[model samples]
Target chain A: MRDKFNEQLEQLNVELIKMGALCEEAISAAAKALLEGDAALRETAAAAEREIDQKERDIESLCMKLLLQQQPVARDLRTISAALKMISDMERIGDQASDIAEITRDIEDSPVVSHVPIAEMARSTIGMVTDSIDSFVRKNLGLAQEVIRKDDEIDRMFLDVKDELIRRIGQGDSGETCMDLLMIAKYFERIGDHACNIAEWVEYSLTGQHGDM
Target chain B: MRDKFNEQLEQLNVELIKMGALCEEAISAAAKALLEGDAALRETAAAAEREIDQKERDIESLCMKLLLQQQPVARDLRTISAALKMISDMERIGDQASDIAEITRDIEDSPVVSHVPIAEMARSTIGMVTDSIDSFVRKNLGLAQEVIRKDDEIDRMFLDVKDELIRRIGQGDSGETCMDLLMIAKYFERIGDHACNIAEWVEYSLTGQHGDM
Candidate 1:
């Protein structure tokens, strides 16, 4: 029975890793679509979002079954519960990525603004998300902490993006274009937040206490 | 033992309602702060946010204890698990409210813009949140659906807010002010999303399937 449980647990970890990879793909596609004015990648990101949603349901059922069939105690219970919470964040990351794609689709034909630091912000956020998931899969507390620390940088980047948009608007740029850029930057910041949340859950699962505790 | 479980469940419901009310207060306070240029009310919202965070931690511990000690199955398990998910949404609602408050604090001394329709959006979102929690407590699937439907109106209002901000920016209004208003409207839209999520979980608890299912 213990061996079977461990096997199932390992399967859960594998599924989570797959879901994380999907999120990474979705966000990276969305970012590239936004930066390159590529409308086709928006569709790609949307498809990935749908897949991520399906993955969430699959992982949720697995966690519920593990909880019910195994009635896991202590660390096992925490791991499953944390997986449950982590997937919600992962699913939202996917949703936010889709949202970014939707916005990029709308602005795909518009004249591109070159001054916003959005591409760099997107890269940083993607790294944070990947590191957070890796921290979870490897149970690396230090990596999780690093993800948390990186959030401040994302926040700062968002402010920079906002300021840049404001400056462009004041310089007589189209308000609509500025608004779209601002929204995309804000989505990247939100994705960073979800990544931080996943890292915190990873920490909780490993140590049985969140960072605040 | 069954009676004790029922009693604990009732207590959990009460706490959830209390947390929901706090969310309503925080959002309302933040809205008033933004509309009235009331910096004091921003502080009030911040205080409520702190309380809401405390309540989340408390409720989480209670849920964990219930899960570990009672080992509930089937419907009972669903209800507890749904509550666990609902609190995360509720906590996010609180955070969004506080975020709105923070933006208002920065703009409180600025000349107020009166055309954003934020007040109506806040009222609609607060109603959705209240109804979602009520649906959970009463197991009212109809009310849950109502809350879900209400989300569309909030989304529409957010678009209206965005349009108004863009119009103002085009009319040579302060870019900073427009950006602040846009962020506040976005936060309200996000609160509506969280409320919809809570309502979906409530529906899941009652029907054993999420809205998507």
Candidate 2:
């Protein structure tokens, strides 16, 4: 029975990691689609979203089964809870990718004012997300907390993107153009926030406190 | 041990319901402050928020203790997991309320925009959230699903609110004033969506499905 539980946990862990890998790819594809004006990559990011949704369903079922079969306790309980929470953040990260893709689709051929610091922020957030869940699967609290510490820097980068976006809008960009830029900025910031949320959950699983200890 | 477990479960139930009740009140106070033009009520809502945060901390610690002592399984696991998820949603709901309060604080003295459908939407969301948690405490799946169905109404109301706000802004309202309205509308939409999330969890506990099972 114990061995079965371990195997199930292993399956859940592997699936989540795969989902995270897809999310990382989506982030790259979406950002490149926006920055490089590569329309085909936008479709690639959008196509990737359906796979993330499938992965989410697969992992959610695995989690429910783990709860039913494993009957985890204490630290085990924390692991399952953290994994469930991590998936929600992961799914939202996928969502931010989709958001970026949708914006690229809508803004096709429109002249972008500038795409500064957003790709950099996306790179940073993707790294944090990958590392946070890696920390969770590896039971590395130090790495999880390290991801949390980088959250402020992501926020700062988001602000820089926001400042540039706002500067354009204030200079009398049309409502449609300004709205598209604002939405893109919103997606980038949201991706960072979700990574921070995942990192916080990992920390909680390790320390048995939400943002505590 | 069973009796002890039941006692802890009941205590957790009580605390969660209390927090749910507090969340309902905060949303009401936030909407009331906006509708009645009572700037002071925004302060009252802000003060209430601190208590909500404190209550959240207390409940989380209590949940950890229950997990440690009861070491619950099956229905017990479902109950505890449901409580944990519900509390997280309630905290987010409280954050949404605080956002509403902050918007109120910004535009307390600004000219009103025809009352709109905001109060109605806020009331609907608050009631849905209150009842969703109530459904959990009572373990009433039917009631929980009822809350799930109304999520569409909440979304529709949100669209109406957004349309009205944008129309008002387009009519040459101060950009600052319109932004405050936009923020308030967005907060109402989030509170409703969170209520739906709580309802989804309640359904999960009942039928082992994510929502409306």
Candidate 3:
């Protein structure tokens, strides 16, 4: 029975990774749609949000079923619960990606601003998300903690970029497009937050640590 | 044994409610500190934040113990997991409240511009936080959904207030002070998001639903 539960858990881990892949895809689409101004990619990512949504629901139900039917024991129980927790953050990461894409769609015709800081935030956040799951699969609590530690950097970058944007708009760049830039910054910050959450899930799974952040 | 497990679950619920009460206290202190420019209140809220953080860890540890020992079936497992998720959100809400208090400390002399919208946002968000817990206690999906629906109002109010603050600051209000105001709006928005998360957790406990933002 324990082996069967582990098997189910393994499948869950796989499905969750797939979901994470989609989130990365969506985030990539968001940046590409904005920097490249590709409307087709924008539409594709927007439509793909629903798929991520459905996967979240599906994984949630599976987790629920695992808890009820498999009656997970020991670390398995914690692992399944952690998986459930991670999925919510991952799904929200997808939402943030979609939100970024929406902003990109809105600002398609706007004058270009330097995308360096925003991309830097996304790249770091995506790294966290990936590493968190890798740590989860390997039961690497140290790696998970490492990911959590990096959240401070993500937050600092978010603030730096936000302050810069606010200062720019403060300096008379108050075009209607400012909101889109603000929203993009907001979405990137959210992705970083979700990455932090993913690391927390990894910690919860491995050593029962909760909310070092 | 089953009776003892049920009792422990009930006790867990009670403890979560206690944590919720702490969250409630923190939010009020933070809001008052922000609006009334009370320095001591900020310190009080910050101290309360420490307590909330400790309570969160304790609850999570106790919860993991219960899950490992009781091996709860179906509803019991759901309830326990739901509490785990809700407390995370609630604790984050506590952090946001303290964040608001800290921001208040930074900009104590800034004169208030428009209180009604932000005040309304705080009121509604607080209402959602309270109602989400009530719904969890009552196992009322409808009540939880109500809180979820009210989140839109809180978001709308947040956006309106933020825009107004930006406008006022643009019109010669202190830019330095606007940062404080922006942080307050951010804290309020975060609190609202956490309330929505709590409501979602309540819904998950009752029906295992987990999607649609």
- The residue pairs in collision within model 3 are none
Which residue segments of model 2 deviate by more than 4 Å?
A1-12, A26-77, A99-106, A112-121, A138-142, A157-170, A207-213, B1-6, B32-77, B103-108, B112-116, B211-213
Q: CA shift at A12, candidate 2, in angstroms?
A: 4.6
Best by DockQ: 1
Q: What is the TM-score of chain B alone in each candidate?
A: 0.97, 0.93, 0.94
| Per-residue C-alpha lDDT of model 3 across residues B103-205, encoded as one tens digit per residue | 7766765665344365666677778888988899889899989988888887787777767766766676655566557657767887888888888888877
Candidate 1, residue A80: lDDT: 87
Extract clashing residue pairs from model 2. Answer: none
Ten residues in sequence with the least summed lDDT for candidate 2 chain B: B169-178
Q: Supply candidate 3's per-residue lDDT for A13.
A: 80
Once superposed on the true structure, which residue ranges of model 3 sit more than 4 Å away at CA?
Answer: A61-78, A207-213, B61-78, B112-116, B203-213
What is each candidate's fraction of native interface contacts (fnat)?
Answer: 0.47, 0.00, 0.00
Query: What's the lDDT for residue B88 in model 2?
Result: 75
Error of 2 at A109 (Å): 3.6
Distance from true location, Cα of B151 in model 2, Å? 2.0
Candidate 1 C-alpha error for residue B12, in Å: 1.5
What lDDT is reached at residue A202 by model 2? 83
- DockQ values, each candidate: 0.60, 0.20, 0.22
> How much DockQ does model 1 earn?
0.60
Per-residue lDDT tens digits for candidate 1, residues B25-61, read 9999999998888889999899899889889888987
